[model samples]
Target: MRIGLLTEGGYPYATGESALWCDRLVRGLAPHTFDVYALTGDAGQEPAGRLPLPPHVRAVRTAAPGDAEGGGPGGRSDRCGYGRRERGRFEAAFADLAYGVCAGDVDTGAGPHADPAERFAAGLYALAELARAHGGLPAALRSETAVRVLESACRASGARRTLAAATLPDQLAVVEQWERLLRPLSLDWYDASDGLGRVDLCHAASAGAAALPGLVAKRFFGTPLLVTEHGSRLRAHYLATAGAPFTTPVRALLAAFHGRLAGEAYRRADLLTPGNAHTRRWQERCGADPDRLRTVHPGMDAERFAETGEHEDSGDPATLAWIGRVEPAKDLVALLHAFAAIRRRQPDVRLRIIAAPVRDADAAGYLALCRSLAAQLFPAEAAGAHAAGESPVSFEELGSPEAPTLEDAYAAGAVVVLSSVAEGFPVGLVEAMFCARATVSTDVGAVVEVVGGTGLVVPPRNPTALADACLALLRDPGRRHRLGAAARARALELFTVEQNLAAYRGLYLELLSHAPVRHRAAPGVPFAHPAESHVPGSWADRPAAPATSAPVKATATTVAAAPGDPDA
Candidate 1:
């Protein structure tokens, strides 16, 4: 079956979230054809070039948010130039959407009207239809008339108080952001013959902008949308905008718009696969159907750490390793403080801070500060007869001789430590598990879930708790060995790349099997010809497989339970 895989800032790109996982999935499921629709975040992400795509990818279409600058789909010269009638249509639709956003109230309770949600959806589809007819929405959405419509809606009697306070600049910013976020509506990827309409399933790699196209495909062509969110995009938006320069009203309005979008996506999606329970809970809070939600953990290749897993005693008995990008969120400062406490308790203990490449200026500054703090905490000793030149707290990169690779980094310590104040799936912790190394991680994001009784989890930002956990592991080699062995067993059983591929493949087949078969009927033939069979096999000699026009029915048993269930 052909799949329309949608992504935002990921996949095919050399750097982006989920690039590796998406590439692995596409390669693993070589039997299916994929049409990639990528929404790049910026120009720089593609400079290093994309990862080599597998042959099964039929085509890849990329669009950046900056594309909205040209006014619309075909550019400034090809603007839709809406007529009086189209202008009226745009006014009504845009007003409804803006009102729905400013209202800031969607009935998410049981059996509620969901009027705000429905209005937002209705206005959204109307704009999409207009864009499809006119070749783009930029010209209309960018007009002064659009700004007036938004202002009127925000000033309406029932609007949120924050929105009523929006100034002209705030209005302009909100409208510009909406234009960018809604750019997918102007895309020509919905045609039945050549675009998303032709695919059997629309798999969105994440929510928000990337999932918008999938929502459109499902709405227009009845294509089943499978939304897999590794991180809750809605939550991310709220966090990201917390410090934005925009006015409170503008931020509130934008948040409402994104909230409505998430609700609609969740409502329309046939299946919601969150990478972990943390994301699943966020989806559920946004009104995702409990029955439709399934937790599919991100997969990692264990073979890369197989050698380390087999030889658990190779690492230094006193070293504690922290492997990941050095960012503020990683709380390396707290790690440093905790390491100081560990040193006080055991002066011979060493800490290896294996830094991944920093991605931004902020992270670079943070790394420099961490280095300075390390110098203050463990100043280099003089080169005496038995003195080592290296600082007790060493910061090393991936290719360094001490930590040649990720597997080597995990193998360089008896206890792996994660001190992040925020995380998604705790990929590093899972990698350490794959290496069969005991871990001391902070209780953040999915660390507790991923650790699953194998590692000691401490509260984030608490140096004492972190140091105590590290000391507990350091003081007991037998316990570390037991936990390491158990961790490897759990990692192999639950988090391997093969398991992820199989889960998705099952989900795809399950969704397709239950979906209505789209086929043209022959004249005067009532079940006389077989256009397509729902079941797999050569059915040329058999009668047409029974077709049901009923909505797809999913039983409680349809989705497998989370992996490693005791009963199983």
Candidate 2:
């Protein structure tokens, strides 16, 4: 089947969310042709180029959100003002969105009859149609007309107090952001033959902006849409917009837009695959049909850690290891504090903070802060720490001599530690599981789901709970071994690439079975006739009266007139 893989700020890019796993999935399901429709974010991700793709990926069409603001020279989006009629259309569609958001008409758990969601979708698609017909929105959405519509909506009757109180600046800010998020609607990917219309299925690798193309494809071409969310898009929007220097009006507006979009995506998608049950619940709460939802855990390559996983003996008996990026969300400071508490109980134990290479300035600063905290907590001269220039807390890279590979990093610890205050799939935790290492993780995001009772989970940011959990695992070798074995078993059965591919392979065929066959030939779109192979009837059960009819064998004329013969 031809799959249109839709992604945002990831996949094909060297960085971004869902890139690695999506690559693994595309590589694994190589039999199917993929046409990637990727929307990159504001970071100029295209400059970084893309990851090497397998041959099955027929096309990789990458566009940045920046494209929405332009049409190059002599194009429709050349900062040319919309015509009077075009202005009317733009205003009406923009008003539907602004009014829906302003009045708080967004519904999280509503059916198709829900007017709020209906209006949101109607407005979204209307704008998409306008872009398709007019070449693109360009400056229309960022024009004064849009801001006027938003201001009018805020002051309209039944609008929320927070939105109604929005100032001019707030309206402008919201308009700018709204235009940014709506970039997908203005893209050239809406072409019927060369774009998403040609694909059999639209596999949206994410929701929100990434899924917008799939929504359009399904609407225009009857394309089957499959949306997969490793993390909840609406929830992420809420988290990102909170305390983000925006007024309540801006925040509420952003949240409402994302909520409405997510609800629409859930309602229209043929299937919704969340990476974990935690994400599944988020979707359900956001009005996704329970029947359409499926949980597909993120998959990793197990063979990378196979030798280490199967080994009976690996890693230091007295060490706890933390492996992941050094970000504030990872809560390295909390982990250091927890290690301080662990040192009080067992002075001989060591804590290793193995971080992936970080490029962001903020991440570098956060890493530096963690190192400083570790120093203050465990001074070099401290008697209880490891001897001979070794501190109790050590920060090292994954490829360093001491930890040559990811497996080596996991192997350096008897118990893997995850101290993130926020997480998605807990990939590192699963990697540790694959390496057959016992774990102590914070109970946040999908940590509990991934751990699944195999490892100890403590509340986030609680040094006491974290320290206690680590000590328990460290002190009991037999318990540690049992948990490690169980974790490895679970990771192998559920989190490996093979299992993930198998699940998607089945899901792909299942979706196609229900979808109408799409044809490229000139006979025109035909009936939705399904093969009746399963019906219990003589048609299915009867052996041929072939022997009776065999006497009427093919004559020369009949043979000449066979289906494939050119001449009769």
State which candidate has the highest TM-score.
1
Candidate 2 residue lDDT tens string, 1-568? 7789998878888775489889999999988878998888655787777899998798888777577645322222322267888888888888877767666653545544236667678778888888888878757877788888889988987677788678999888887888778878888897765788777889998778889989988888888999999999888888887769988878888888888889889999999999998899999988889999989988888999999999835888999899998888998888888888988889899888898888889999998898778778877535444556667788898799988898899999899999989987888899999999999999999988898979999899899999999999889999999999999999988888888899999999999889865433221223221233223356542233454353222223211222321111
- The best candidate in terms of lDDT: 1
The residue pairs in collision within model 1 are none
C-alpha lDDT score of every prediction, in listed order: 0.84, 0.81
Residue 52 accuracy (lDDT) in model 1: 94
Worst 10 residues of 2 by lDDT: 559-568
* Model 2: how far residue 79 lies from native, Å: 9.9
lDDT of 1 at 1: 74
Tell me the number of clashing residue pairs for each predicted model: 0, 0
* Over 4 Å off, model 1: 68-80, 106-114, 379-388, 520-568
How would you encode candidate 1's per-residue C-alpha lDDT over 480-557 as one tens digit per residue?
Answer: 999999999999998999999999999999999887664422334344223343343464323434465542222332
